[model samples]
Target: MANDRRMTTDRFFGGVGERLENLQALFKFVDTTEPDKAELQDWLESNTAAKSESTIKAYVGFQRSVGLLELEKDQYQTTPRGATFADTGDPELIFEALLENVDGFETILQTLDNEQTTTTAIQASLREAYPEYQLPQAVVGRHLEWLQAIDAIEKQQSADRYELTSFGKRLLQEKLDQKPTIDDLEIGSTYDRVELHEAYGGARYRGIAPSADYPYVFLFTGDSGTEHGYKDEFRGDTFIYTGEGRTGDMEMTGGNKAIRDHKEDSCELHLFENNDEAWSVTYLGQFECVDWFEEQLPDTDGDHRKAIRFKLEPVANEVEFTDPDLGAVDTDELYERATGAARTDDEATQQTTVETTRTIYSRSEAVREYALRVADGVCQGCGDEAPFLGNDGEPYFEVHHLYRRSDGGPDHPDNVIALCPNCHRRVHHGKDGDAFNQELISRAENVESDSGK
Candidate 1:
C-alpha cells in the first residue's frame, strides 16, 4: 500500500513539476532577499525559459495579480502566500498540516450561526490553529471550497459554517494509520491567459459606459484681463462667459451693471447653467470681492481675455448652493462659529469675529432630540415602550423629520418627531407617515360618529 501511494505521489508531482517550476521562479524573486525590478528582470532572464523582457515583466505582473508577489518602492517581495507557504523551508510539512485540518473549518460554521464574524475573527482563528503559518483569507477560502468540491466538508448559509462529510472522516481515519503524502492533497488547476479572458468575456464586455450627460452644477466667473492700461479699470465689466450660456450677458445687466458703473468695492458675479439637452443659464448674483485677483487666477489659462475663465476669488458675502434631489448643500464659511474654547489672544479675536458673523448647528442631533420630545418617549399610536433605551433607562428613540432634507425641510425641532428605530425605518420606507396618519384620522372619525349614532 505504501509503495502504491509512493507511485501515485511520484506521478502527481512529476505531472505538476513544470507549473510548479514557473511558480518557484516567481517565489525566488519574491523571497525575503527583496530584489528590485532590475534585479528581478536579470534573475528572470538568467533562470527562466522566458525569452523577452516583456514576457518577464508580464510574468512578474501575473505573479502580483495572483497574490504571489507584491511591489513596494520599486522592489519586489514575496507575498504572504509565497513567503509562508509556497517556498518556505518546510513547504510540504505546512501543506500537510493544512490538509489534515480540513475538518477544523467546522468552527467557522459554528461562529456564523451566532453573529456576523468579521474577517479579523477568521484570521485570529487561523493564527491560533497554526501559530507558525500566516495564511491570507483568500487562500483559506479557496482551500475551503476545494474541501467542499471533494465532498470532504459542506458549507452552511453563513460564510463561517462547515460540516465534515463522510468522505472526509474516512480520509482522516486512513491518514491516522499511515503517514500522509503530498498525493493525499489536491493540486490546484490553472489556465492560460487567453482561456481566462475568454471565460470572463461576458461579464467584462457587458455594462453601461457613463457619458458626460450626467448633470453636474458648475460656477462660472468672467475673465480678468491683464493690468494693461484702461483694461485694469474696465475689468469689472468683463462679463465672465460661464460656458453654461449667453444669458448671463442679459440677467446681470441690472444690479451687476450698477456695481461696475459705480466702481463699488471689487465685486464677484455668479452664474448657474445646465449642460443636459442644451446649455442654459439660470440665475446670477454679485458679491463684494475681498481678495487680490492675481492670487486667484486659474492655472488652465493665463490669457484672461477668453470668453470665460473658471476662477474662484474670496468674497465677503455668503452663498449656499444646494441639490434638491441629492439633499447635498455647499455653503460658504460665513456660517461657521467658534465654540468659546479659545485660550490665546489671537484665537479669542478670531472667535469673536466668527461668532458675530456666523451661525452653526448640529442638524442631526437636533432632529433626534426633537423627535424624542414629540413622541413623549413612547410609541405615539401603540403606546408600547420603545425597545432602544439609553444608559439611564430612558426609552431609546430616533427622530424623524416630516419633510425630508431632499424636499428642503428645515432641521428644526418643529419638523421632527421622536420614534423608535423600527418605527422610524417604517415611517420613511414603509406605509409613510402622511398616509398612515390619514387612515388613523378616518378611523377616529368613524368611532366618534358611531358613538353619536
Candidate 2:
C-alpha cells in the first residue's frame, strides 16, 4: 500500500546500523494499511514495545532512507521495497539487499564470514584489521546477532562461536547460484546393472527381474581380504547374511538402496561367499529376506562406515549345494583341528587389515552326524530323547554351533551341540538365546578348547 514512483536508488538506506531489530520492526510496521504518524507510533509501541520514541523514530528513518517507506504530509505508506520485504519474509534476500545498500554492514560480514569467532573475538580481530573503525564490543555483538537473525551466519552454541551456513557462504562469495534440480531415479526403474557370474547366474535369477521387493539381484563376495564386508554363511535352511551398505571409504549406495527395498518374504535375495580361488564366488541359493540391524564392522581403511547386517532364510524348493571339497570330514578329527586353531588371546579377535586371501568352506555334514551320534538319540540340551524319527528311521535332532562360526568360532565337536528342533530354534531366535548358549557351552563335557579336550 506504499507508493515508490518518486524513489531513487541513492535514497535507499540511511540509518541501518548493527541493530537489525530496527529493520525487522520497520518491515512489520509497513505490512499494515496506510497509517498516520500517531498510528505508526502506536503500532511500533504495541509490536516492538520500545521504551523510547527516538529508537522507533530511528527505525522509521532507516526505512525511509532505504526507500522502504515514504512518509508524506501526515500519512505513512510502504514503498516497493517495504511491500516486497513484507510479502516474502525472506531474511537472506533482505540481508543481501542490505549488504548492497547499507553502509558498513558488508564490511562487518566480510570480516567475520566463515570465521568461528565469538562477538568479543570478532571485535578484537576487526580492531586489528581496521583500527580507524574502533567498533565497540556491543556493536560487534549486535552485528553478529543481526547476521544470525537474517540467516547470514550460524551460531554454534556448543562451541560458543559462529560458522557460515551454506547460504551465508554463498552471500560472502558474491554470488548465489540458482538452486539445482536433481533427477532422482524412478521407483521401479533400474538404478544399477550388475553382471552375474557365469557359474551362479542360472540359479540366482530364479525370480522375475525388478520385482517390487527386490529391485535388483545383488551379488556380494564377502569383504575383500583387507577391506570390510558382510559376514555371510549358509546352514541347513537359512543363509545367515549381512546387508551390503558400506565398504572402505565408499558407501555402496546401490547396496543401501537394495536394503531399503527389501521386505520380509517379499524381497528375494541371493547369497554368495568367497571360494579359495582368487575372485571366485559360490552361489548359495535364493533366500527370503528377514530382519536387519546396524553393526560396526572393522574397516581396513582405518575409517568406518555404518554397516547394516541382514538375516535371511533359504526360500522353499531352492537347490542346496555344499562345498564338495569339505565332504563329511569325521567330526572328532574336525574337532581336533578346530580346537588346535582356536584363538588363545584377545589379539586374535582384534580387527586388522590383512592383505591376504580368504575362503568360505561349507559346514561339514560329517561334523553334524558325529555330534548326533555322540548324543546317541538324546537331545544334548534338556537331556530328553529325540522328538521323532526321521524318514531314514533315525532320531531327528539339529546340530547347533555353541560359538557362532561367523565370529571366527571354529567348526569343531567342542563348539557344536546336538539339540532338538525346538531347542535349536530357541537358542537362535529366543529372547534369552545368548544366556542359553552360554549354559550349553558350560555343560558340554566333550567340548574342548585350545587348552584341552
Candidate 3:
C-alpha cells in the first residue's frame, strides 16, 4: 500500500510536467499561428487532451501574466520573451542571455520569419496574447512604436494590418548577405556634375531657350485738344504708357516730324530730367530739332505753315525743365519745395482766431428725436428705421444745417428738420440740395394732411 501511494505521487508530478509542456506548446502555436482567441481555443481542444475551455482560458491568462504571450483584437500571439524561448527551446536560458551580440537579436528575425508580420503587428499580437501581463503595455508597445516612430514599420490607417518597412527589409537582406563590418553607414556626399547629369539624364542641363522676339512698335497720334490743330505723337515698342507721360512727344515738332523721319528705324528716346523747373529734352534719340530758317522762307500763307507747340506736366519722380536748352532742370526736390511753400503760405493766410467766441452745440439728440417724431423714426431715403436703431434701442439721427454756413445758410432751428443722417448729409453736402429739401417739405405736408384727415 505504501509503494502504491508513492507511485501515485510520482504520476501526479509527471502529469503536472506534461501540462506545463502542453501550455508551452500552446504558446508556441499562438506565436506561430497568431490566432484569435476563439481559433486558439478550437485548436487547443482539438489537439490536446480533454481540457476544459475554462482551463485553457485560465492558462492563456496565466501566460499573459508571465509575459510569455500577448493579446490583441481578441487574438493571441507570442511575446518577445515567448519568441526567444521558442527559438532557443528554453525560456529560462534565453532570459539569462545577454543581448550584446547580433546573434541575440536573431530571435526577432526568427520571429518575423515565423509570423510573417510587421514588428508592430507582432508586438500588438503579443499584447493580445498576454493581456494580463505584469509588464507595462508601454514595454510591449515600445518595439513597434519605436519602429513606427522611426518609419521602420508601416502603420495602416484604420486596420490591424502592418508590414515590414523598407529599412527593415534592407536590414534583413544585409544580414543574409553575411557581409562583415555592416556599418549601416549612409554615404554623405553631394553628386558631381557628371553624376547629376547621368542620374537626371541631362534633362535639367538643357539651357533655357531664348524667348521669341516681338518687334512691333506702336505709334499713337491724337489732337492736343487745343486751338492748334497739331496732333500729339507717342511712340513705343508697345502702346502702353509708363506713367511718365508721352516720351516721344517732347520734341520740337511734337514728335510728329521726328517719328516720320525714323518711321522704320529702331531707336530709344530717353528723356531724362533737365535742369529747368519744367520738362526739357535730354538725350534726344538720333534726331535733332532744326530751327525754322527764315532765310529759306517759302511763299506760303501763315495758316498753311506748320507751327508746333508741346506741353508736358511734371509727374511724380520725373524731371522738369524751365528752359528749352534742357538746362536749369529740377528734380522732385523743386516740387517738394514748391508744395511746402504753398502750404506754408496757406497756413499763414488762415484766421488765427475769431474775434468773438462762439458756443458750439451738438443738436444731434434733438435732431434725432425731432426726426423720429416727424418721419415716425423711418429713414427718409429708404423709408426704413434700421439705420436709426442704437444699441439701447434708441433712434439715431444727425443734425445738418438746412443751408450750409459756408453758403450763407442759417444755423437757426427753424431752418433745421429731423431727417435721417443719410438724408441730412445729402441735403447739405450732396449735389442736389434744393431737390432734397423739396422732397422733405412734400413729406411734411403729406403728414400734416394725413393728421387732419
Candidate whose lDDT is highest: 2
Q: Find the 10 residues in a row with the least total lDDT in model 2.
A: 1-10
Residue-wise C-alpha lDDT for candidate 1, range 345-379, written one tens digit per residue: 98668766663443332333323443454467687
Candidate 3, residues 104-192, lDDT tens digits: the string is: 12234334542346545555444332222232434434334433433434556677555556665655455546423212211221123
Q: Which consecutive 10 residues in model 3 have the weakest lDDT in total?
A: 1-10
TM-score for all models, in order of appearance: 0.23, 0.32, 0.19
Give residue 53's lDDT in candidate 2 (0 to 100).
Answer: 76
| Backbone atom clashes (below 3 Å) for every candidate | 8, 5, 24
Residue 224 in candidate 3, Cα distance off native in Å = 99
Per-candidate Cα RMSD to the true structure, in Å, reads 28.8, 22.5, 37.9
The stretch of ten residues in a row with the least summed lDDT in candidate 1 is 1-10
Could you give the candidate ranking by lDDT, starting with the highest? Answer: 2, 1, 3
Q: How much is the lDDT of residue 391 in candidate 1? A: 90
Q: For candidate 2, write residues 337-418 as lDDT tens digits.
A: 3344443367345523444333333234445655776788899888899999989788998888886643444455566778
How does each model score on lDDT? 0.39, 0.54, 0.38
